[model samples]
Target chain A: MNTTGPDSPSRRELFRMIGSVAGGAAMYQAMSTLGFAAESTYRGPVDLSGAPRGASVLILGAGIAGMTAAYELRNAGYKVQVLEYNHRAGGRNWSLRGGDTYTELGGFTQQCEFDEGLYLNPGPWRIPYHHRGLLSYCKKLGVPLEAFVQVNYNAYLHSSKAFGGKPQRYREIKADYQGHVAELLAKATRQSALDAAVSREDREKLLESLRDWGALDADFRYGANLLASERRGYAKEPGGGLTARPLPSQPIGLTDVLDSGLWQGIPSGDRYDMQTALFQPVGGMGRIGEAFARELGPLIRYNAKVVDIRQDVHGVTATYEDLAAPGTKLQARADWCLCTIPLTVLAQIPMNVGAALHAAISAVPYSSAVKVGLQFKRRFWEEDEHIYGGISYTDLPITNIAYPNTGYHSAGKGVLLGAYIWGQNAMEFTAMPPALRVRKAVEYGSRIHPQYPAEFDNGIAVAWHRSPFTLGCYGMWSEAARAQHYDNLCQVDGRIALAGEHASFIGGWQEGAVTSALDAIGRLHQRAIARGKKA
Target chain B: MSIRHVTIRLALAVLGLSAAAAQADDASFMPIADLGQANGEQIYQHICQGCHMPGGEGASGAGFYPKLAGDPRLASWQYAAVTVLNGRNAMPPFGLPEDRISETRTVHLSDAQVAEVVNYIRSHFGNTYADTLTAADIAPLPHPR
Candidate 1:
């Protein structure tokens, strides 16, 4: 019980000491022990080789989950058909460009007006390296990949109430914060404050590491010096000839660094999901969905909205209204059904399932989110501020501005994600009309990028709650709800099963859809085989 | 002052009262916490009107938003209060803790605010319920764990 004594080292302090002595690899190992890092469970493709002959599966919603199931099931010798509500293959995996029009729930239509070769991906945009399932499909489908920058040191971290509303460069904040922390730790070690935590031999090594890692001087202090400038950038460049002298920039005070709250933005890229080597599809996020559609062209029936779903001892049937021809009903039947419809819409459909599954269906609620994409007359962020291919965060309602990761230093107009708003902010933005949402985004974003007023050409805003296909952005599963209902939601009730991002632990991600589909179909295939054997 | 100037000042004064209570004057940005909206009408306009529509007549396309204007459910203020405090189906709970709802930033309505909005909706929008509910009524309602 005397763990607070000097002899007992806290886990955090032990990890920090290990990170200081060893390198990133040891730090990653320590993090892994604490359950901070999670690797993808995808090991190659799904093995569905034993699908029973004449067995059929009717998939609902041609989103990532539906398409993935259809593709894999068909390849495994099962006859599969997919019904989609939207005319397009990708439901939320959508990209908007010039000539594309969208009509939301309120009957307001917006036509994207970005120039050629410029588009906005309003859905799942980036694919992490560990998301082997989605990445494997990208490779198999011939969708080229490009690096998506998650963090740019040259980008800005701003607080409206701090720094007199002036933006601070991310590199300065990061370097100064690390340097000051290192200096303080070194001071503690020199004073023998960490004597019980570290051995005498390790203490010398720790001070040396602090000097190197923190850019501390001979006296083990972090201040205005050329070494600190090397990490945080120099005020004056070291020119070639006569003006070769460099002026070091002063580090912000530790108090100011802590008060500004810019430290919150530093660890964004360090998260497992947003780490480095993140990638995007070449054209847009929708390209992966398009590739799936191209592969499963005839099997997918678009613009088919299912009104009723019923299952008997023999098979499953879905009655859908063909939107192209209003008031006409058509039925699709199969031996098995894998429904990937979002629960928000599925709750309204008449489906026969157990009370447990029905309660699970009605338990989870979706989140409200808004994203605004603005087209500017020029690449002003790169040209003016030297910020290329990263996000600038602010406390304003327009949460953050993300610059286009591709087409760096090109001529013509550029597009920026002007706002990525969530929660109450999203609801407020959703309350306004489409045009007004765009205007308000431009107005709030102007506080960060002053060039917005003059350079704004055209913009489009999407409130996920107002979007007809998905009532809200993504499924929000409370801890209690997930504990009580998650397994029930995933279980197969009679001849039907459900799979999507909503059913998986990784919500709001394509990887979730892919992995959940694979998991669901794996079970469905086994059931189909078992039924065939019995029959 | 000119008549136009006087009218503009009067309008701004009314707006300022709400803004001062919210502790933010920017028309475009609304803070998530401590909204400080005065009454039920203002709270509904600031929060509920987005999905429920301006007149409480909900819209449907991709998903259905149930109409609240002439709904028979408002007859029982307890039903409305419980639903608002603990969401059903696709609607998130407006009165729960932010962490409980899995949202980092969301509208967290106090008991008084919930009562106000509930009372306002019950009386207006074609519903004539003279019964009134108070914060005391809402405070006792069971919340989802």
Candidate 2:
């Protein structure tokens, strides 16, 4: 298929069609229920007359999984109480609204192609159309989908040459710019010590390509090709393709292929491209947390740090301290409890009957990620052809960035770009102070822009690792913990329910959180019915 | 001499005009596979991770690869015909094989079977994402990649 033709349907038009149809259906439903309000909110307490004997449910954490489970269980008429350690909910799915614009600090993008009439870009960018559940959720949410531009990925090996000034694409420079890195890597593979000692030719080639890569205005196809080539071991075999070698087995190159090919699955043209949809919702991603607060209402008590969850074969009792008012302590009795807190936090949480449960909770493993958002005074890439947006280099602290204010309002002037640091770098970034982190980001950005002092400014930062309740961004499996443990994490332990992204078999993401919550609710409902029969 | 000079100028003008027109005509139809375009390579690098993956085993944040091979979705030949057109929970809408859209234009597949790479992804990664989604039964995906 030729991509440069004019007759193709723009992604915006497709989304418009989807939006009009979906919006019409939703509007029709809203009209039919115009006069109706939901029924009374009293879902009956967990007393013997209401909740069946030996049945009580408590949910901790107000994140997506916890909220989903609580909402579903409540709908099923199960007596439920949700306990959240944080003041709000939505977990990592955070949105920040300042001025007239809303920016999501976490989990920004979702893909709608997987599910018809869906808006899936929850964390920054939209997913590829292949994402089924996220697309389905988009259809459920009634948000139209968009596309990110599909382009090749490129990078420079040298730090000084590629860093600071303006970002550039690969083609704008001489075609031979990236050839040097390939040559060096191939040579290094055969001669280990020689690889460490750069010859004049290697150094010259590196500098030349760095200058050209920096001067070019084309998308770096290196990352994109790496995504395709890696699967086929393109990098494993030398000289097959530029992406054919280095990190032969992993998609790390592909991951940098485009921090988010938010446009890879959608239509052509910027009209409906995802650059327009990326935003941080007002307040925090936690504003979505307000939804839980609405449903849970006054039952949610803040600063009520939970100390223990103990069941005496009769019912479940929870002990906590009301940190809000000193000397204020409270105890709640329920037929059941749902523990949504992280297993790390759960281990520290005092549970009397905990030998087995503690072991299971402690066994779950999690990976950490660091996100740093930089608010710049101006969009420098717009001013210089040499500086392409979304430029990547190996030496920088942050490898990915996106131009967020690319909408009608953004005259391509001053814009705030979001930067992501993952894996080891993320861990390191989390340890730094706000000023230091900003300084590092600027320094990294300057490498791409020699004139960084003129184009860049300062901004704020947040470290998810330092967050008390979250402990880490989400879960990642260690070599020791196989897929079976993840499968078992979804299991319901009698009346005690588990819900959280970590508790999910899918492991680390917002989708895991939702799926796990939905599963827990179904299991809890079944348990409630079974207890009723026994009674 | 005067006549010859005028004729030469006219000939040069004609050549320049034809060259400009040719450039304009060719502008709208850039081929899908450009030697150094970088966009296709970038798309292949980033979006293919979920289905075809870095190793092309058809696995990533999503499930396995067999589900992607010869998928019915790519039959439309649109840029969005691959993984995202059908959809995945972990995958997004735009980066699928069918979603290979250009900033200035669109790409439609020449044939339905071109999506066989999805099959290649499946064969390598084993099975995932679909339940009994046979190569023969894959319906054409919605959006072109």
Candidate 3:
């Protein structure tokens, strides 16, 4: 007779769930015993207010960094509000569902290693064994993990005439050309070694030297490629490498790395390894953001897009228009504001402050990207079981491909391939009509798996450049940008703190965003304490 | 600074146009897309409340803790489907009996009912891009037992 829509479980029931099947208590005990908690607690939440109880903080852009700043500040007992221009949070970090498929359109992959899994970014993750923030946060949130397919190894380069395995008329090409490439690879390896050896402080000098050498090496390689083709009678050879032809040296130019897989053994150990670059959350990365949002509860108001930011000597006021209701305007006042919006969009924002802030923001630059997600009707990669995971397609001009089979329930019937393009290629790729884009993807995909020509049934792609909400992806650092602005980009403007992966020393990586947010939180806490002294 | 100021002004102006372009509903305050799914709370109560619970707290004790209330994993609809159909860990499979979905009435929830519950949960608890869960979303997942 008493039907109250089922009895709500008491706290005891919750605790019982933890003790029994959920394994919550056991996990907690393990975490504590293993000193995981101790290590995590050392980092601690950023100090909110050193002296008083109440302080206000404003965060811009609801991406990982802004969300993290809010989490830390709110947990530390500071009033926080996040204003996002986009209709939703998670900036360039986003996932979409289409026709029974989950595809990541933005910054997709992260590697888990050690407590702080150094993010082996699919974007700029060429670094050796560097999972830091990605792994640490997963541990913090109690998420499960799976191994990352080591795509770094086993890449084949298609040359101007043939695939990398054996160039046509290989015996005819002058030996100096091969030696030149080997020398350049060795130099790159040595420079990378030097960069790794020094303290984080002295990395700029090494980076500069490496950049100069890289340019020279690329130029020499360009000349060598032309000569190799012409003198070695390669006119009849097949044009193979993606971007097989090289361009003149300029401010920003892409060059080919050594085609051989020798770099894997180059022996420059940083902090981690590919074997440990594990990914796969118990659910997925989106879960992390959800956990952060749930903990904050209603504090995170969706559909509130901050339009304008105005600050005074006393406090900061953020002007936001409710995205759900266009005509409505909402204002929130805070003592501090953290802006984690990607630099690309941030550069265009209408600021109440003057040119100095503009100059500071303009200093941060972003590279464009077009992520193409192709879903095949069947797993064509399985044809060559040796290349079971759908080979990286490394030799092609395209980014990479994968068979996402690691999850517990994956059918292994479908194949998900993505191309991470940047700069002009990215712009061109995104600008191309969707139909043309699909055709080009199919053409290239078929080369690797003959079945792809016919087996490909349906696909979807996101030209982020066209998405008005998120104009483009994260910022990639230029050589000069790194030397000039890496340290300064993370600096807070009074109560305004900047946080995002682009704000970190390692620009264009999720680790950069989370790490920078953590750094900003630390600084905000310090400022709060300093403010107490001033009071 | 001038360029940015002008850009913002232009952006606001453009935003105004875009807003006008959007089809406005009677409840102008609530999004037009959200209004369609606003009435799903009841469906969640009647059909889903058994496993996921009434307040949407979910089955926490006995054997498997299928937290429906605020499990962060529910943010993505794909993750939401896995447990609802396959029955992860100790939770029994609800959508399909023998490896494959027998018919359109997968998970014992009709397309409308699924949409209603999905809307209820997403609107009330977590963030979902769309209001209603389409039949395509609850379509037979490629992977079976």
Best by TM-score: 1
Q: Cα-based RMSD of the predictions, in order?
A: 5.6, 25.5, 25.4
lDDT string for model 1 (B50-142, tens) is 778777888887468888888998888889999888877878887886445434234677788889999988887787888777889999997
Kindly report which residue pairs in candidate 1 clash with one another: A468-B62
| DockQ scores of all models, one per candidate | 0.48, 0.01, 0.01
Chain B TM-score, model 3, reads 0.48
Docking quality level of the chain pair in candidate 3:
incorrect
Highest-scoring model, lDDT: 1
Clashes of each: 1, 141, 21
lDDT of 2 by residue, B49-73 (tens): 3124344333211012323344444
Report the candidate with higher TM-score, 1 versus 3: 1
Q: Which candidate model has the greater lDDT, 1 or 2? A: 1
**By TM-score, highest first, what's the ranking?**
1, 3, 2
* C-alpha RMSD over true interface residues, each candidate: 2.9, 16.2, 23.3
Worst 10 residues of 3 chain B by lDDT: B23-32
What's the lDDT for residue B10 in model 2? Answer: 64
lDDT of 1 by residue, A204-244 (tens): 88788788878999999999999999999999967888899
- Which has the better lDDT: candidate 1, or candidate 3? 1
Report fnat for all candidates as fractions from 0 to 1.
Answer: 0.63, 0.00, 0.00
